[model samples]
Target: MSKRVLDVGNCGPDFSSIKAFLTKNFDCTLDQAHGMEDSLAALREGNFDLVLINRKLDRDYSDGIEILREIKADAVLKDIPVMLITNHAEHQDAAMELGAKRGFGKLEFGNPETLEKLQPILG
Candidate 1:
């Protein structure tokens, strides 16, 4: 069976690339959430093996961090692997402290390095 990924943030070109790469290389289904409400709704609806949270939503980077905290605080969803994607590497430490599996730069998506880093989580 294919794993499911909840991509919470912009579902535009950036997410499209990540989705295309992941679907083509890995056996997984990727769904998107435009913002916090949509993300919460999606989480309530089904199970997701992983969550890809972008640093910016429609507004700013803080929204993603807020959603990340919510997911970590929830008993039901806390166990899911959450990865924070941002342009700055500085966000990595904060994301990890909030229970994220890892934080990767937006530029890393669709590349072999990111793919390799995702192996353990995907497995």
Candidate 2:
């Protein structure tokens, strides 16, 4: 079975890396929704094992935190792992408490240790 990964990104290189990583590690298929509305629409129609949300959106839209809350509130999507990937360090603890499996900063995005850190949760 193919696991699905969703990226709520603003057309960045991060999406490419994430797609590559999941393809290499989990043989997963990736689909991305660019912003708040797109992400929500994608959630309604697709099934994902993991989700990556950028903390800040490109335009004036709902931030990752609000998206996190919406995902958790949905009975069907609540169990799927949602990760907040950001440059901000301050949101880590709050994200963990808000039902994200983990919060990863941009600096660590491609680090060797990053995959190791995610192994326990994503493996």
Candidate 3:
């Protein structure tokens, strides 16, 4: 079966590349949830192998650390791998400390936030 990815950024050109790449490279199914709460709710109700979280969100919420904390705190969702996509490598240490599988800079993803490096983690 195709692996499931919870993309928390919704639909946008900025994220379109990653979405397209995920399908093209991994042949995975992506379920896009627009907000923090929605993504959290989905995690509670369903099972997802990984989560690709964008640096920003629909609202003014760009804080992925707290969300990462909450996810790790949850018994059911703690094991789900979470990857943070950002333009700053500075967040790498902090995010990893909070249980994020990894953090990537916008440039790291090149034209998209999807990278082959994600294969092992998501696989």
Candidate 4:
């Protein structure tokens, strides 16, 4: 069966790149949300195997950490695995501290290590 992933806060090109990469490597479907509200609503309404949140939202350039916090704080959504898409180690560390899995950077999107990092969740 195909896994479902929720991709939050990415712009058009970024989202397209993520969708293409995921579809190519795994049996999965990708859905996107541009900000906090839509992301939360989509999580509540759909069943997802993983969530990829951008470090900075494309729509308003708002912090995506807030969205991550909200998900971790919500009882219903807390268990779903989340990964923050960023290139900075500090940000990645922060997300993991809040219960997210290790995420990959957009700069390393097609790297072999990125795919390996995603294996446990999407494999």
Q: Whose TM-score is greatest here?
A: 4
Error of 4 at 39 (Å): 0.4
lDDT of 3 by residue, 1-90 (tens): 788888776347656766776777775887877776888999888878888777666456677666777889998899999987776677
Report the C-alpha lDDT of model 2 over 1-123, residue by residue, as the tens digit.
Answer: 667778886455767876776677765788987776788788888877788887876456557788888888889878888888786767866778889876677677567777776665456
TM-score of each: 0.90, 0.82, 0.84, 0.98
Per-residue lDDT for 1-123 in model 4, tens only? 899999999999999999999999999999999999999999999999999999999999999999999999999999999999999999999999999999989999769999998889889
Positional deviation of 62 in candidate 3, in angstroms? 3.2
C-alpha root-mean-square deviation, each candidate: 1.7, 2.2, 2.5, 0.6
- Please give the range of 10 consecutive residues that has the lowest summed lDDT in model 1: 54-63
What is the C-alpha lDDT profile of model 1 across 1-106, one tens digit per residue? 7899998886588788888878877899999987888898899899899999988785454468889999999988899989888867678778898989775777
What value of lDDT does candidate 3 attain over all alpha carbons? 0.74
In model 3, the worst 10-residue window by lDDT is 105-114
Highest lDDT against the true fold, candidate:
4
List runs of model 2 lying over 4 Å from the truth. 120-122
List where candidate 3 sits over 4 angstroms from the true fold.
Answer: 110-116
Q: How many backbone clashes does candidate 2 have?
A: 0
